[model samples]
Structures are given as C-alpha cells and as structure tokens.
Target: MPANTAPIKWAQRSDSLYVTISLPDVKSESITLTDDKLVFTGTSGANEYACDFEFFKGCDAEKSTYKVLPRSVQMFIVKAEEEEEEFWPRLLKDKAKEKNQVKIDWDKYVDEDEEEEAGGFDTSGLEGGQGMGGMPGMGGMGGPGGPGGGMGGMPPGMDMEALMAQMGGMGGMPGMGGEGGMGGMEEMMAKMKGDLENKGGDEGEDSDDDDLPDLEES
Candidate 1:
C-alpha cells in the first residue's frame, strides 16, 4: 500500500503474520505475509498505506516488547503525569505571621522601656515640695524652702508683667537695670541718646577747661 492510506494493524500468531487495514470508507481486509515485505495486489482506495516490516520483530499479545523499541519510538509511547500541592505556600504564610508577631512584641517592649525611662518613678507619699535625693529642684521634707520653691511663693493676683520684668533683669540684658527689665527697642535707643549727650557735654567741659590756660603768670 502507498504511504498516504490508513494505518495498518499488525498481529502475530505463532507461525504466521496477519495484517488488517481499513480501506477508505469501505470495509477492512486481512492480508497474510509470507515474506518480510507484504505487497497489496488489489486496489481499494485512491491512497495507499505501506511500510517495511523487516524491523518489526513480531508483536506478542502476552508480553510487551516496548523496552526493545527504539528510543524515539519509546518516548512517544510513555506519558508522565505530574501532581501539584500547596505545601510551600502554606509554609510561607506561617513564616510571615511569625515575623509580624515578633515585630509587634518588639514594638511593645520599646514603648514600655520609653515609659519607664520618662517619669514612672515611685514617688508616693512624698510631700509636694519635698526633695527626692539628688533630683534637682527638690529639698528635704519641709515645704517651700526647696531649690524650686519660688514657684510656690507667687502671691495671689500678682502682676505677670512685673514678674517677667524681674526675671528678665536677672537674665542679664544690657540697659534693663534692676527691676525695670528689657524696655523694648525704644527704651534702649533713648538710653543710647542720653549716653551720647553726656559724652558730648564732658568733651565740651574739657575743651573749655583747656581754653582757661595755666594760671602761672607767664
């Protein structure tokens, strides 16, 4: 048969070889092969299917000879099936959850440490103005005589402006003498003018004194 016809099914029986092939749209026919090459004598279809059976070692129904087949032909017969699972994805999710938990615990520990460092000291039963050893602005038991006691001595309804002026003077700003502190830019300018006038008067007095020559009857 020619190469374009339908495929041929070869079956091997004890001492004979039987070949059955379907002809076009008609019935199939069985042919006996006496030699290695089998030739078709009658024509059944326009296309002919033929192949050389010299290498077809006989087909056995009970024993499969696929292992003895050529590597290229064996590759086309065996198929591999793959199995998929979600093992890695679940493990990754668990690891991420553990990491997030660790981060939360770390943040909580840092916040607790910050609070303890800020002002969480045990200061109960201690008088409001009493000194707590080595702590600045505190003094022993008796109230109001401590280092920061001025805050306790402010008189009722005291003028804030006067207090600030006193503080400014103690803070050392030029020209703001004693209790009259930092008298704005206008006050500083006025003081400067007065100083210049005094200096000018002193110079004038020195000039007049120079004009009054030496009283030595020269």
Candidate 2:
C-alpha cells in the first residue's frame, strides 16, 4: 500500500520559503531537493508518510536547510536567483496540487513590505561595548548569543519602533543630553550650579534688607 501524504504548512519571504511538515517522532526520514522539486518520506510507529512539492520556480537546494524538531520537520528553502527575489503567489508550480495537504503558515508569514522595513534597519552603530557608563550588563544584554539576544534585549513580541521611540525620549532627560549617554550628567550638574548661585544671590539681598534700620514712623 502507498504511504499517506503528510500534511504541511508553509510561509515565505522574498527570497526564502519556510516549510513545516506535521509529522512527529519520525523513526526514519528522507528528503530530496532539486531546482524545482522537493520529495519527503518518513515513518513514525507503523505509519509511513510521503509528500512531493513542485516549486513555483527554481530554488537553491544547496543553500537550503532543514531540521527535525520534536513535533515537526522544518525546512528553509532559498531562491536560486537572489538578484530577482520576489514572493511566489503560490507555493506549487501546478495550482491544482495546492489542495488539502498544504496550507499557509500564517504564524511565520510576513508581507513583503513589512519584511523590508524590519530588515532595512542598520543596527551596527548601536552596539556600544559599554552601554550607559554606569550600567553594567546592559551592553551585552541584547547582543547576539546573549540573553534576549534575538529581540535586542526587549521582551518577546515587543515592537521595534516603539522601543526606539522610547530610547529617543530617554535622550531628552535631564542627565541624558547626548545620545542618552553619561554626558547628560554634566549638563544636569551645570544647571544645578546656576540654580544654587541664583539662590545664594537672593539670600544675600534678604540679609542686606535685614541690616537696614527699621523705618521710624516714616
């Protein structure tokens, strides 16, 4: 008897496709890839499953990769031609083949413009080895391979734009005048000194007034 066709989910970016096979604890598995096709077979317990996908266009099989997770097999497929990257309207070359076995992976999906905006931000300049002079660990908190690394030390699912805006606001604080760093301390100290001098002058004026003889029935 022929093996059953395994169910699959998929999402895509401009240059890559993310595919997930919903077969768990596979005892054996086989995967084959070419410029325009993918073939998969696996066994779990007594059940055998298989699937074949004819891609909408050429793919770079050499650069693609896959991983076997506890509950799924995840695959990342790259487009053959990076210079002409674009999202395929559908995953399969034959539209009719996109039937019950395949579905959209909405959880991993991002539209073209959204992906562009997220990827366009250049973060190289933000990697200051010493974050906020007095704050240790802050520099390495969100660094690559560090804690909360992928999200830039931010809580998971936090909006990047919102975080950046918050940081910008911090730069305006009394002791955070320059790029929200330690330089603000100097500005705050100077302002405090001027305030103290003004208060001293006022006190001196009051003292002189007190020294004047009281007006006698003027």
Candidate 3:
C-alpha cells in the first residue's frame, strides 16, 4: 500500500464544510457519494487515480453536492444531523490505522462564517472571560487571547488561498477597482494619455500666432 496523492482540502463554515479534491480528468459518471463515503475513479496524465474517503460523522447526503471543475471537484458537506454549528477539530477523523497506515495530525479546521475569532488564542478561566474575542474586554484591535487577533498566535490550519477565494466574492477585495485591478490602471493611463494629447493640441494652437506670416498685409 503506497501513499496517496489525491490532494484534498477542507474548510469548515458555520453550517457546513467545503471539501475540494484534485480530480482532474474524472468523469461525472465515475464519481460516487454515499452517506459517509466518497469514491472517485479517474485518470490524470499516465496514471490512474482512485480516491476513497470515509467520514467520521454522517452528513446530509441529499444536501451535499459537488461541482466538477476542469481539474478538480469542489464539494459542500452539510453538517450532520447530530453535529452542531461549531468548529471542527479536523477535516476527517484520523483513520490511518484502518487503512494500514500510521496516523498523522492534520491541520485543525476553522469556522469560516464566524467573524469573532480570537486569533486562535486559547484562554480558559473563571468569570465571563471564556468567549471568542478573548477574556471579556480584552478583545479587538487584533490582540492575543481575544477576537480580532492576528493569525500569528494561532496554529496554521486554514487554506488561506481557498478561504480568501470563497471570501473574496462575499467581502469584495479592497483596492481591486471592482473586478479589474489592472484594468482600472489601464483606464487611468488611457485617460492621462488622452489629456496629454489634448494639451499638446492646445499648445500648438497657442503657438499658431508665432507661425503666422508677417506678409498678411503684403
């Protein structure tokens, strides 16, 4: 049993988890989904790929659907009936032993929909201090042990690119000039060039008197 290279990524949301797999050259007919298992048989380049994964918890199979892309597949797994709206410790349960492999820790999962993050600052004490934004008033401004904290204090778990891609549409990237960052720059340059050309024409008109012949009366 050799190691696998299916390359799957997962992220948790308030109500669901998004799981994306690199499934290039996979036919829609070759994909299968069950209550707690996912199997895909496909080919990429000269190699044949067979990806199979069984979930630790049951999901709403009827609600869970996948979108096939040119090179991969994106799946949305609704929270299981028994699960609550909370952070998932890991994408999948550690079942390496079942597959005759050693168990390895994977990146922890985060809730994508929650804005009240503690920068992953772990704090647990008495009083009304055990909240997301850190101990009571000790939150905000991106500080430690509180919400709005920086990502440094937290363990690296999020697929930042994927998270941002999903968030990019919802939050809309700032300074992107509305869908066209460089296009905005091109528009500005074109306008500047047009203005310069108009200015040149104005200068030529102002100097038209200098080119006038003194033989106007002659």
Off by over 4 Å in 2: 118-218
TM-score of model 3 (CA atoms): 0.41
Question: Which of candidates 2 and 3 reaches a greater TM-score?
Answer: 2
Please give, for residues 1-218, the per-residue lDDT of candidate 1 as tens digits.
Answer: 24443333332222222233334432232232221223232234454343223212322222111111111111001011124211111111245432332122121122333543543222222234212132222223223444444455554455767776676666645655533445454467798999999999988778556678688876
Candidate numbers, best TM-score first, in rank order: 2, 3, 1
Instruction: Give candidate 2's error at residue 143 in angstroms.
Output: 20
Index of the highest-TM-score prediction: 2
- Candidate 2, residue 89: the lDDT equals 92
lDDT of 1: 0.33
Clashing pairs in 1: 2-48, 2-49, 131-139
In candidate 1 the C-alpha lDDT for residue 192 amounts to: 97
- Where model 1 places Cα greater than 4 Å from the true spot, the runs are 1-6, 24-34, 41-43, 55-218
TM-score of every candidate relative to the true structure: 0.18, 0.53, 0.41
Write model 2 residue lDDT over 129-210, tens digit each, in one string: 2222122122334554333555546665668777656655656444456654534655678899999999999887786567
Alpha-carbon RMSD, candidate 2: 12.9
Of candidates 3 and 1, the better by lDDT: 3
Please, what are the lDDT tens digits per residue for candidate 3 over residues 69-175?
Answer: 66766565566766355665555555562344212223434434442571331222211211211122122122343333335333235566655555555654557
lDDT of each: 0.33, 0.70, 0.52
